[model samples]
Structures are given as structure tokens and as C-alpha cells.
Target: MWLKVIKFIAGILAIPLMAAVTRAFYGNIVGVVELAGILKYFMWGVGAYIVLHLLFFKPMFIYVLGHEAVHAVTSWVMGGKINSFKVSDKGGSVSTTKTNAVVELSPYFIPIYAIILMAVYFVVAYSYKINGAVFIFLIGFTLTLHLVMTIEVMKIRQPDLMKSGYLFSIVIVYVLNIIIIAMLFSLLFPSFSSKKFFADSYVFSRDIYAVIIRQMFF
Candidate 1:
């Protein structure tokens, strides 16, 4: 029971927590910009949101899809035969008859691919750097996609990894993710630390039912 509880905490904290943090901080800043009598803030916010969701949706989805594909492909490459694979709105799973550290670890190493994509983006946009505001919005989108993938990887695929005192693994994933996010931001905008964003957080999705019930009477 304790093991499950710890695993749940670790898995949830791995990525979703950080993503939630980013949203909270950015959302709050946007709100503050609104309060500062900046009409353009809202315009930029809305425009950026719409453009990001529209233009990047397909590419991000492909990235998300390819992310899982990497896992499956890696498994095959690592001498593990995949038995079954499933993906849905919430999570995904891939069963294998045999597993290796490399295959099992592939899902958590998305920053490697992200780095390559970011490089290509920079090269194409080389003459013009991606602007700061746009970069913030882009990282926000990327982080959200990352959260979804992390939920799939952490909660469903490798719950045991976080539970096994593999604190080193968690650190590695966190640092690598931060680096990739920061670099991607640097390519366009000035970078910010995860700490600057989310100071504290609650897992809203996991507690949505409770939150709804509590807010219903209020």
C-alpha cells in the first residue's frame, strides 16, 4: 500500500506537476499583464493561444504519436518483441515479452528527439529568431504535450521505475526536460527556470471529482 502511494506520488510529480506549474505561472503573468492596463496583453494572449493551438496542433500531435512510436520501435530494436500496444486520450501501454533497460527507458528520453526538432526549427527560422512571447507560448504548448506523454509513460508504462528509489532517474528526466525546454525557449525567447514558474501545486486532474463536488455548492 505504501509502495503504491509513493509510486503514485513520484509518477504524478515527474512531469505533470511541472507542466501544471508552468501553466499556473504563465496564466498568472498573463492575468497580471491584463491588470496592468495592457489591452495588447489580452490580444497577444488570445492570438498566441489560437495560433499555437491551430498551427502547431498537427505537428505536436505527430510528435506525440511519434513519441510512443519511438518506444515501440526501440523495444523492437532492443530485442524485445512487442505483444500489444494501446493508446487513448488518457494513457497508453505497450506490452513486450522481453524488456531491456534501453527499451524500457526509451519513453522517458524524449528530450533527445525534441532537441533535434528544435535544431531544425532554429535552422529554418535561423534568419529570424522565434520571439520571446511566441517562445513562451510554444514552450507552454510543448510542456502540455510533454505532460500528456509523461502521464502515459509514468502512470501507465513505468510506475515501478519511480517507486524503486531511482531518484537518479527522476533527476535525469527532470534535468533533461528542463534543458530541452530551456534551449527551445532560448532559440526563440529568453529562458526561465521551472522554479520561477510553479512554486507549489495540487494535482487537479486526479482530484477533479473532489474539486467539482466542493465547488458545486459554492
Candidate 2:
């Protein structure tokens, strides 16, 4: 009970951080818009996925498969022994000997499908000289797939969210998503560095918290 209470407080405190990260994401995009070479391929891939989504061609089964696989993989990474794993078009579940915030909430944050795609790219690159554009396009495609599914799933009550306290789960998921996406952007776009991202995040967080403090006290 006390642990849940602590998580609740931490969750509330994390709102400022989430907002800051979100601001940094927008700022990062604005910083780099030179669509000449590789960036164009990335944008093309993003646009393609957007088109697919609009046509109601969502691959829910694929999302569910990757989602449950992440749960099982994260459990193993955290020293938990998996008992059983099941995934279907409707939903998925994984049972492990260990349970924690990381294991339970990982599917929401970790883009397992992206990692799988990256692995495939690496393997192909090892043998053949993979084009930079192809790599960027694949990253863009898989990343969109992960982000879209994550947003849709978060709309309703999830048992995973309940375990970690829904507020805390959401804060963690949102903040991690922002950070992960920002890191990927930084890697792909040299002009938009992570250093600038952190600086912007701090400024945004400070201003948001300042406003909240003033509202409460002044």
C-alpha cells in the first residue's frame, strides 16, 4: 500500500518531465528539416505508414506479437523465468516467475519490433553494403508501427498499467517514449544533437514547474 502511494506521488511529480520531453521532441524536429538525402527516405517511410493507418490497414496481430515478445524478453533480461507465453490477434499474455514495474510495463516503452528490424538491418549490413536510405526507411517504418500501436493501446484500461499504478505507468511510458524517439532522432540527424535536447528539456521543465508553483502558492 505504501509502495503504491509512493508510486502515485512519483507519478504526479513526473508530469513535468513528460511535458518537457514532449516539448523537446517538437523542438528537435524543428531544428532539423533539411530534406535532401537520408532524411527524405525517413520521411517517406513515415508518410507510407500514415497512409496505411488511414486506410484501416493496421497490423494488430503483428503489434500483439511484438508486444508479448517484449514482455517475455524483458522478463528474461530482468532475471525472471518465464512460465508461459501466448499471443493472438485479440490480445496477449506472458507469465514469469518475477514481476516488477520494468517487466510489466516494458511493452509500452520498448519498441521490440524496431529492435528486431534493427537486428535484421545489422545482419544484412554485415554481408552486403546496405544503403543508408534503406536503413533509415526501415527505422521510420517500424518506429511508426510501434508508436501508433502504443498510443492506441493506452486509450483503455490495461492490466499492466494497473499493476504499476495507472498514473505511474502512463508517466513512465510517455517519458520513455519521448526519450527513445529523441535518441533515435539524434542518431539519425547529426545537426540535432542530444545535448541540445537535454538543455531544452531542462528549460521547459523549469518553466512548467514554475507555473505550477505560482498557481499553488502565489
Candidate 3:
């Protein structure tokens, strides 16, 4: 009963969370648009996404690996012992001694591949003068891959969502993905700071909430 109540509350909160994220996303885009020469690199990401789809490079194996890996990693971080980890082209899963919403739902929100690519980009860029175009292009490619794979996985009835209650899971996933998308835009545009992105979101959310209250009471 309490769990259901919590889920209901989470469902309600999801609306405002989504509104905040949308505001933040718009701000990130506006910041990117103001920067010169950055749009081309971003387009390279879009182009890479188009080419991958055209070539039918689904790479289901890698997706499965990352999915299971995220589950295992989060489980371990939560002080849980992984009993088994398996990955296949068809699907993959991780079994742990402990389970919670965070461990169960993390794979859907955290883009492990994108994070790895960012680390590699930093390392390689530090060692050599890498071409900015290629670096941004690869970032775009990997992030697009993550987004596609995430959408594909979510289309079916995922056991993880069942374990973490559908409403709660969806809310968490939606908000996190929005933040991730905004952060990616910030990464692409050096002029944008994540702090400002979040601050703008807070202000936008506050104004939205004030308007909502006025509509309900006034």
C-alpha cells in the first residue's frame, strides 16, 4: 500500500521533473546555437546516427554486454554480490544477492558507452593533438548508439521496470535521460556550464510551479 502511494507520488512528480528537463534542454540548445563552428560537429553526430541505421549496425552483442555490465556494476556499488552475469545477442541479465530500484533501473539511464568514450577522448586528447571534428563526431556516434539501443530495449516489457514499479522507473528514467541529453549538449559546447544548465532548470521549474499553484487556487 505504501509502495503504491510512493509510486503515485513519483508519477505526479514526474510531470514537473519532465518540465524542468525540457527547460534545461532548451537552454542547452540555445547555448549550442550561439557558439560558432560547433553545429557542424553536432551534425556529424546526427550524420553518424543516420549512417549506422542505413548500414544496419545494430551491435546487439555490445548493447547486451553494456546492459548486463551496468547492472553488475551498480549492484556491486550498492554492496551486493553478483552471483551471475550473462550476455547474448538475444538478451542479457545480471543476478545479484541484493536488489533495489537504483540497481535495477540504472542500465536504462546510465550510458556506459558514452561515459567510456568521454574518458578515452580525454586521455587521447591529452596525449596528442586530436582533430576536434573527429572527436566530436565519435562522441555523437556513440551517444546516438546509446540512445537507439536504450529505446529499443525499452520498447519491450523489461523485467527491471517490473522489479522497480513501472511508474517510478519510468519517471526516473525519463528525468535522468533528459539530464544526460542536456549534459551531452553542454559537452559539445565548451561555453556552456552544467551548473548554469541546472540553475536555469531550477528557475524554470520554480516559475512553472508558481503558475500551477495560481491556476489551482486563484
Candidate 4:
């Protein structure tokens, strides 16, 4: 009975959480558009996305490995012991003694491949004058890969989300993905700060509340 009540309350909170996240994401995207050379970088990203989409590139092997790895890693972080880990081209899963929403839902939000690419980029950038266009293109390519694959996986009924509660999982995944996208934009354009993004979001949220209050009274 209490669990049902909790889930109902969480579902109610998810609506507002999604709204706030969408507003912040839109504001940051607008900010990114205002920056110089952003269009060219964006084009590079778009081109990369097109190429990947056309190729129907699906790194199921790598994704499966990362998916299970994230489960194991998070479980360990939460002081849970892993009984076994399995991965294949079809799918992957982990067996752990510890289980929670964070552990279950992490892989959906964390882009392990992108993180690997960024780490390699940093190392290469230290030694070579990597072309700006190429760097931006790769970023776009990997990001699109992550986004597309995530959606494809999410289309199915995932046990992880079910165990975590659908409303709670959706809210968490949306918020984390929004924050990650904002961070990626900041990485592409150094001028756009994550701090400023949050500040703008706060202001936007406050204005929205004020408007709602006025509408209620008037």
C-alpha cells in the first residue's frame, strides 16, 4: 500500500521535473546557437550523424559490454558483490547482490563509448594539433551513436526500468540525459558554462511559477 502511494507521488513529481528539464535544455540550446562557429560544428555533427545513420552502424558488442560493465561498476560502488557478468551481441546482463534505482538505470544515461573517445582525444590532443573540424565531427558521430542506440534499446521493455519503477526511472533518465547533453554542448563550446546553464534554468523556472500564479489570481 505504501509502495503504491510512493509510486503515485513520484509519478506526479515526474511531470514537473520533465517540464523544468525541457525548459533548461531549450535555453542552453539557444545559447549554443548564439556562439560563433557553432553552426559549422553543428553541421559537422549533422554530417557525422547522417553517415552513421545511413551505414546502420550498431556497435552491439561494445554496447553490450559497456552496459554490463556499468551495472557491475555501479553495483561495486554501492558495496554490492557481483555474482556474475554476461555479454553478447544480442544482449547483456549482470548479477549483483546489491540493487537500487541508481545501479539499475545508470547505463541508459552514461555514455561509456563517448567517455572512452574523450579520454583518447585528450591524450592525442596533448601530442598532436588535432584539426578542430575532425574533433567536432567525431564528437557528433559518437553522440549520435549514443542517442540512437539508447532509443533503440529503450524501445523494448527493460527490466531495469521496471524494477526501478517506471515513473522514477523515466524522470531520472530524462534529467540525467539533459544534464549530459548540456555538458556536451559546453565541451564543444567552451564559452557556454554549465553553471550559467543551471542559473538560466532557475530563472526560467521562477518566471514560469510567477506566470502560473498570475494566471490563477487573474
Candidate 1 lDDT over 124-180, as tens digits, reads 676877554453344445555554456545554355354343553564455445444
Q: For every candidate structure, what is the RMSD over all alpha carbons to the true structure, in angstroms? A: 10.3, 2.3, 2.2, 2.9
Q: After superposition, how far is residue 166 of candidate 1 from its true place, in Å?
A: 5.1
Model 2 bad stretches (over 4 Å): 33-36
Tens-digit lDDT track of model 3 for 85-142: 9899989878899788888888888888878887787888888887877777777777
Best by TM-score: 3
Pairs in clash, predicted candidate 4: none
Q: Runs in model 4 with CA error above 4 Å?
A: 33-35, 41-47, 50-57, 207-218
Candidate 3 clash pair list = none
Q: How many residue pairs clash in each candidate?
A: 0, 0, 0, 0
Give the TM-score of each candidate: 0.40, 0.87, 0.89, 0.82
Best by lDDT: 2
Ranking by TM-score: 3, 2, 4, 1
lDDT (tens digit, per residue) of candidate 2 on 1-218: 99999999999998899989998878787768544556778888888888888886888889999988888888898888989988888898899988888988888888887777777877888898978887788788888888888888887868888889989999999999888777766766677788899899999999999999999999
**What are the clashing pairs of model 1?**
none
Winner on lDDT (1 vs 3): 3
